[model samples]
Target: MNQRIRNCAAAAGLLFTAMTASAANYTAMLTGPKEAPPNSSTGMGAAFVKFDAASHVLEVDVAFGGLLGTTTAAHIHCCTDTPNTGTAGIATETPTFGGFPLGVTSGAYSNTYNTSLAASWNPAFLSSHGGTTAGAESAFAAGLASGAAYLNIHSSLYPTGEIRGFLTGAAPPVPEPASFAMLGLGVPAMLLVARRRRKA
Candidate 1:
């Protein structure tokens, strides 16, 4: 048992060392509020976005109140990395909410968000949203591994977004596999330690 315990400990230590060697778990966040510009029937729009580095999943939550008249449509555009509305692309290769609001208007409209699809997107999207406010998770890795990403908000009146932000920072970066190795090894090490201590 002692030998087994020691072996497990050694294994765990090795794994921890390897895992700690690197880390990953980045996240970028952005919000859209009434502060949006007066482009749509309303004056502004509101939005909430969260990106998961590991899963590369993007979760979005947006609400536009005080609409000029009612809701029409909205979008996450890729305009600029720096804050403010710019002329960019719409990098929503995959979407959560394409161009429709969550029923703010009383007219014909529909929104489609596939929960199964990964919300994580390229920097182009983030730049469109706003470099300062828009956010992306795992985006840093994708950027380092590929490039950057951004976000943008738009409406019928302002088909060009009214509010925008960006996902800045090196990003949380991907977690080191070694840490996972540690977690895997640690479980056994802890079990062994507990058994030995209890044995006494």
Candidate 2:
């Protein structure tokens, strides 16, 4: 019985480690009201972001419409002083995301960034965070986890930022295949051991 308990605890530890190492998903509903110093532009947008710490990959998707002015730039800002409020400097590519739609009131964008590369981060942001891609990646991930990261879209009408939203949501971690297999075998074995002890 003691041996069985040890085995079960080991399996649980494996599962916990695997789950904690997985990727995270985040989403935001962008609107003028969510913007700092709120606007009345009637524009709306949505953003979806996924980050894989192990792979150092960041994926971003955005859709927006009904803007009062043409699109100018869009990027992510991070490490706000307060969560879900306030403003922060851009943490993503400068000017705008690569291949982002320009001069359009409504558009959709999808892009994947290799966060391991310098091109994926704003120069100032990267410099401030220990001047390395790894440092920037770590800081960005922390910002997202703490609700201090946001997606913003700038327009001709509101160059500072017409519509924006704080990114929220940290998906439950998923266990790796090996961890799943361990749980599958360990759980049944644990139950069998318990049943035998009960019979005894």
Candidate 3:
């Protein structure tokens, strides 16, 4: 193999890695009345999340508005039997969100949880649902796919949950290893042919 072949191999490796590794996205629409303990308050919320399968990293962005009282805490809950009903264990890094000294009725919250880290799981969840971080993440991902995962926001008025919404959307699957291998071979074959053509 010559320099051209080596460069082609490197490029194919990168492409294969890129194809096999990617993130899954999920979103939710929350409302006060959607809470497990429903309320007549005019509050609402929206959440967007990305789960990186390769790294087990969960990135979340949630915004809420019009709560009847000051916001206190929030979390991602999982393994609910049905949407808009019941409560499950927290799935994010903390049971209660931090950093808010004086809670507000409306604001946005963001967080990143490494699903591979034990600290990122609610204790009860770890015990009942999954014993390890990876196991919990797998369960959470399954819940999201089945619309059993939700975002729950707590407020001073409703300490349980002022607003909530079940996460929805099936993330696209990562490419299979065989597909990656085939593509990798094809790239080198094409490169070799092109090199031969240039020589001719």
lDDT of each: 0.39, 0.82, 0.69
Off by over 4 Å in 1: 1-42, 79-85, 93-151, 162-200
**1-200: candidate 2 lDDT, tens digit per residue:** 99999999999999877854666778786778888889997776667787876788888877777788899999999989989999999999998999999999877787889999999999999999999998998899999999999999999999999989899884323334553343344333433443353233
Q: What TM-score would each prediction reach against the true structure?
A: 0.39, 0.75, 0.72
Model 3, poorest ten-residue lDDT window? 179-188
Q: What is the C-alpha lDDT profile of model 3 across 1-200, one tens digit per residue?
A: 59999999999999867844566667676776678767887776566676765677787766566678887778889888875468887877575754522378766666677778778778777777658776777787777777788888888898888878877764223334543243344333433443353233
Q: Could you tell me how far off, in angstroms, the CA of residue 102 lies in candidate 3 after the best superposition?
A: 5.7
lDDT of 1 at 193: 42
TM-score winner among the candidates? Answer: 2
Query: Each model's RMSD to truth, in Å?
Result: 15.4, 14.1, 14.5
The regions of model 2 sitting more than 4 angstroms off are 1-21, 170-200
TM-score of 2: 0.75
